[model samples]
Target: MSLLGATALVAVALDQWVKWLCTEHLTEGRPVKVLGGLIYLSLLRNSGAAFSFGSAHTWIFPVVTLIVIGWIAWMATRLRSIPWAVSLGLVLGGAFGNLGDRLFRSPGPFQGHVVDMISLFEPYGQHFAVFNIADSCLTVGVALAVLLELTGRQRDGSKAVKKAT
Candidate 1:
């Protein structure tokens, strides 16, 4: 539990710090190439989910994020594996990071836009969606969780016993 909490706090702090820096230094819609066009820092405000889907319904995101947070909290009670704890911690941190934006960022509560600044391959997200550290953490954590599950790893730090086919 200590490890999980620490990991979550660190992730949240790092995400927010990077976001603050980008918001303060980067201009919206202007790309600053950091890696010779492979990666660029381009600030954008997204009011929706991946690729700006369902942007017209900004209120739904906060509600969904709350549900996800609740679910993670419930799952925490069953966490015994260090790997699972770390993965879930990352997910929790990412969720909270984005949720903060949804609840507090500009436009209004529960209708605020999330600040995205990292662009890959091309500027202005021409190659992909502009994302943040929180998004990266969510993707990596979910992928790790999926990999663990597929390998029959249990949250209780035990290998699942397979029955004879």
Candidate 2:
């Protein structure tokens, strides 16, 4: 399998497993301190986008995720660089993880809630929104993609050279 495929599968598996563990061990809407209040594991069923944005419109995310997945699949056709593979894989897997919930989890088809459990800065009153493994993977992947772009790294193993003035 290609590196993207392999890494995507790995990310998907890990995301799902971590979500399962959170569902089993974490209490819904109740924070469990993991680092003396610095970090907490608290189950939150996000019905919409990140930070609970648009929670009233839970149906939109699945459609967006589908589009993203399709775009990634199309992009994979020309993937060559290791960085691109890794970034694409992370994106693909994270998308699938949330997509699976929207498809298979409760509340109805294409309107399911995403499982989030990790929180940072709670002790400082920041109460940062809780997130899940899939979110982290997606964030990392997107960050890497941005870094690659800024560094002129191309997806097909070619450098994006600057034009002469």
- Strongest candidate by TM-score: 1
Model 2 worst lDDT window (10 residues): 121-130
Model 1: residues with Cα > 4 Å off, grouped in runs: none
Instruction: State the lDDT of candidate 1 residue by residue for 39-138, as single tens digits.
Output: 9998899999878999999999899989998998888888899999899889989988999999999999999999998989987787789899999888
lDDT of each: 0.90, 0.86
What lDDT does model 1 reach?
Answer: 0.90
- Residues 86-109, candidate 2, lDDT per residue (tens digit)? 998999999999999888888988
TM agreement with the true structure for every prediction: 0.97, 0.94
RMSD of each: 0.8, 1.8
